[model samples]
Target: EEDQGLRFLQAGTALGTHKGMIKIPVWDCKKNQQASCDLSHRKNMEPVPENDTGQPEWDEESDYRACTYCKDNASEYLKHYRIASWFELIEKTENLASHMIQRAAAFSMQYNGGNLQLMCYPRFTATVDDLMSDLDELEGNLGFVPDLIILDYADILLESGNDERERLDRIWKKMAGMAGKRKVLVVTASQGTRKSLMSKSIKTDQVAEDIRKLAHIDLGIGLNQFVKEDERDERKAMIMRLSVMVKRHGETPSEECFVLQNLGLGQPAMDTYSFLRELADSWALLILTLIFLGVIGWAYRPGSRALHDDAADVPFRNEDPEQSRPEQSRPEQSRNDHARQDGACK
Candidate 1:
């Protein structure tokens, strides 16, 4: 019932195709689970029939609701969503033999795991145009653009021992340009150690205020605070705050938001678990195969034994006919003698 339709201006294939070309909204704010639906079909659908009085047949609010797959649908809802971790993102998008090319390709959003919604970039290295071009290609390829973007492991970019600050500036400028075009709204999820350029250069309470002033959502998160064992209470509060902030930024709260954490449960764990599951499944298959073989053997063994017993009990065919011939000859012999005596008397 959750409306899995896109909000669009028109009806039919033309509208769907147009909406498809637009950036897919991203729910990059910090949350464990969220989703967005393409309500274009439903939104563009003709209003239901009205009575002779010319009033709506059903109340719009009560008639429409979220669909069953609302959560799953949210994963790909963004025009471009960020990879949760740099290492994992790099491992998936980067080729060890051709790391640079692969990184470039990833930044361009060329890797297609058809089912996955999130994409990653190694720390920001390219210029604003370079980043936008990459975003453009990703949107074109994925058929959607993320409304939300995250700068992953941003601490490295800021403190890589070089003039990382300038590099950071270029990234922000690119984001500002994109926002101006309404192509995207950016948020950076990073550790508290590195100061953000948005804050330092602008001299604001929070680094994101500049982007916020430009009508975009800007956010900062401390990895330490997010990763603590005793911070559930704080984390819950933070998530609620993020939801509100994202909504206030003119982004559909469910579409543009992000929650980032380095819980040490990255791709390795995912791969290991996948491998273990496959192993368990193979073992189960082998056991089932053996059981089937045993069943086949058990069913045939009785039939084989019965055939052998029947062969042993059966009399020899040639011997049976010879034994029956003598018994038959005795009766004929008496009839012949009686016929000879009657002839002699005649």
Candidate 2:
């Protein structure tokens, strides 16, 4: 499946402890349906009278009836209906407001009281130049440049008549230029190529279209799922492999395995068993080669017959115990005393 850009955006925005503003430009909505609060249907509706219960009184004619009394009281019935609709609207508005407030409170509590302001552009679809113009306008209005700008999906911003590669390259260059000019981080996402779908791992080369896009990015991460054949018990947790495809400063061409805990949030997996299995698999050929070499060496090793005979007779060699022992002898002083005594006797 293709990458879900919106899910990633939501996950990324919620990650980390730093508090900052996140501006999201949604280009999918139509031009007329811009703001969340714009209620076009409310234009034809009239305000309802205060203290008016929605239910009709016993003496009042039902609005649905075709009697003369109903026709005469049509205005009153219409007023009543409007009041009922107004009441329903108020009830719905209250429920929505309450939900939003509770959600905000919960999010605030979860984030340790730090606030993250999320600003969304209404029905925004623009080219590179148009985006730059909007950025300039925003900076002018806010009196300062934003710290971060996230383009939801870069592939959708291609020009009308240009080649795909050329357009993408131009878009990336403009994005890089914006980052440099504003001194702000510009984050964007793109999908992998069709070939990457069947692959076990994703790399920078698997990125859609021209690989030159990697040159514009400081860091690029490729995410892929772990494929296994066991389908018996289907409750196994989902595991994903994340590869560091491109890194301008730090470690690159590295991999990390993780289990998805919630949404796009993943926790590092303890892969000791998997690591050992992979290690053994990777060394199998080398180990076999070494074993073959050892066998060849044992069969054809250059060795004299004399060397083998000497090694074989080492355990059987014996010597006389008496010949190996040293004999006891008298001291020189004792000998000298004896000689002196003999001389005296003479």
Candidate 3:
């Protein structure tokens, strides 16, 4: 896949070749590298017939160079130098990409444990403009636009125009523009300057190509892992620190968090263990104070006096039903009875 020269590879399901679906996938690797074959058809580049001029023409493309053999000396060598090597490199790169994707998918399903549909549309060697165009083509082919587009990395993109800084600015500006225009999130990474490697923290200035690249991003996180000089990977479980360099709408975080990781083994994410243990302790103390205040307020609250009185009378209630009833006086009835008794005696 490419656009720099006439050399290209086309990707599609035509002629019993690569296949793609119209339905949107749950997860997608939306990217185009520096060189890419458009999704036109599954075929190689065919040179157009022209006048028999001994000019150098599109022969083949390799990772290192695009080997262009003159038509007159086409048979003088094996098509072009390192023609076979180009295919071999392509094979290796593809295999690595597939392997990493498979690992990530398996990890997501097994460890994360969710039903997810994954799709990868990989093309290589395209500039920033080519990437945007390819995105349009990809959406049109899929019949649905992707919610997210993850570029492989921005630094490797082919340069355009005259100025170096301007080229870098254009790349990022277009990326931001695409995100807003298409209403899709664009995620890309950039290489860091040499000084950033040793620094415990990363800033916008630490970014390579153009420090102004940070201006376009809404949110930016800097990954810091202390790697020593001439150090070899011992396959140990190392931790990486995350610092928030920019926030779209909120204040930048002064705190950082640590991620237990071993990316080489395809194990990157784990539960975050915060570096602000003291801050956590302070918050815990504040929560306990609130609970104490709540309890004190409940005991001394208004209208609680009646409830306390009812509770106090509960223990004093009589058990005998007869004693609990009221007794009535009958002095008039006694006097009447006495008078009747005297008359009977007389």
Best by lDDT: 3
* TM-score-superior candidate, 1 or 3: 3
Candidate models: Cα lDDT each: 0.36, 0.48, 0.51
Better of 1 and 3 by lDDT: 3
Candidate 1, run of 10 with poorest lDDT: 5-14
Which ten-residue region of model 2 has the weakest summed lDDT?
A: 82-91
Off by over 4 Å in 3: 1-124, 228-237, 281-285, 288-346
lDDT of 2: 0.48
Pairing residues by index, what is the TM-score of model 1? 0.26
Model 2: per-residue Cα lDDT over 27-88, one tens digit each: 11111121121333222222212123332211122222111221123333222111010101
Ranking the candidates on lDDT from highest down gives 3, 2, 1
lDDT of 3 by residue, 1-346 (tens): 2231111111110011112221110110011111233433212343221124521122224222322232112233222221111111111123223343464455556533322223233443577677677667766765546777777676667766778789889878888998999898888887778998777678778888687888899999998775554431112224566888888887888787656543422335533444354345546777889999886676546644323644333323434433554553588768878998999999
Where model 2 places Cα greater than 4 Å from the true spot, the runs are 1-99, 105-124, 158-160, 228-236, 250-253, 264-346
Q: Which candidate is the best by TM-score?
A: 3
Model 1: lDDT to the true structure: 0.36
